[model samples]
Target: MLKTRTGILLLAPAIVLMVALLVLPVGYLIRFSFYLGQTGVQTSGGFTFANYVRLFGDGFYLAILWKTLWVSFVVTVVSAITGYPLAHFMWKAAKRWRAPFTILVLSPLLVSIVISSYGWIVILGNNGVVNQLLQFLGLTTAPVKLMYTNFAIVVGLVHIVTPFMVLSILAALEKIDPLLNEAAATLGANRFRTLWHIILPLALPGIGAGTTIVFCLAISAYVTPAVMGGSGPNFITTLIYHQFVTLFNWPFGATVAAVLLAVALTVVFLYVRVLSRLGAAAPAAR
Candidate 1:
């Protein structure tokens, strides 16, 4: 009883903080979503489902939601594909090389997202480094359209999220027993075979963690998509901003936010379910 009391006391502050900061705001946002709006402005308090109805009923909003999901999926996949090899290398590299490699992988995180987005803009812009290089190489007569495209947004998001993926995979890799690799080798298993059968299975948890984090972050990401994706390839966050700031439709903005929150939660739940199934099946496979 005393230990339980002490634990509760210790947790009280954190619980209070969570309620005050997160729960309260979400509750308020939910309430706000139910309010009615007119001509891009929220009216006096009255409960209505019109905002949600319009969000689901309209084709434009649905298209934006689909685009957001697609962009997030692409970013997560690219981050995982690029991060896995880098993480493996980091885990297997000599002690002297690990620090530098880790730093290189993590350097982007130390910088601000806005700065990073601008850096990508410089590299991916029409007259930027990439186009200049292509011109110098005599590869093209005109600059390639890189900026303000879905490809550019994906590239930026991949760059931002790759560090998270690498760290997650590295954490999992570090937990793996090196003896497992040696044992497989002694059993006449080749490197590729060991990696495919041993390393990958063990690393699925990390990959799943990284993918979930990257997907969540990418789906909610505003600055990178806004700056790189421009006006056409608008994301959910961008639409929320448009409703809240541009149009001053507070009720509708809250509705969009609620929908985004629901979608994010659904994706996370499905991802967890899938990962759990994979985790359960791995032991049987082995």
Candidate 2:
């Protein structure tokens, strides 16, 4: 117990930082959600579930809420599908090749989101590169509208969140012992069988980690959806932004934000539980 106390004391700074930066702000936000913020002033603690009630009661809000979840699901699934091959490719490469490949995967995260959004606008817009190329190839008579659609939003969000997926899977892949694969081959397991049975099981932990990150990001993402969806196919985040900024309803916006946060946290919690179970059994997996 004394050693535990000492360890806690040693890590007190980090604990304090978490409380000060995260717990405090979250507490404030939760409290703010219950109050009316119409006049730039909190009216009351007034602990009413009016915000929650309204969120559930409104049809438009419900539609966008469902849309947000669907979009996030698509983005996460797409990222996992794409990132698996990339992570596997990197892991199979020689040690010298790993660094360069990792750097490449992480490079996109270096650019600002606003700038990336603009770049996508150029490539995905009606007169953009994709449409231009299609036209040039006689695939289309004119530039087909692509920007400010759900597809464009999905593209941008996937681009932003893919690095996280790759990196997460990379961590798990690096830890896998190559000798296991070799031994499987020694026993006559073909390449596909070895991979599907052995390598895949070992890599499941990383896949879970990647999925958690991807799902969380996709669910709560604000900027990309706002820029790409515009007024076309609205999402929960964009709707929340409009409510807060245009209608001056912070309490309701906070409510929506809190609900979204709850949904994200719930998903992550379930994800971690399943991942932890699978990861714990990894040693016994052969």
Q: Which model scores highest in TM-score?
A: 1
Scanning candidate 1 in windows of ten residues, the lowest lDDT window is 37-46
Candidate 2 is scored at a TM of 0.90
lDDT of 1: 0.90
lDDT of 1 by residue, 133-183 (tens): 999999998999999998999999999898899999999999999999999
- Name the runs in model 1 displaced over 4 angstroms: 38-45, 278-286
Query: How far is 22's C-alpha from truth in model 2 (Å)?
Result: 2.1
- What's the distance in Å from true for residue 244, model 2? 2.3
Model 2 per-residue lDDT tens digits across residues 170-269: 8998898979988999999999999899888778789888989898988888889988887733887887788777877788888888888899899989
Q: What's the TM-score of each model vs. the native?
A: 0.92, 0.90
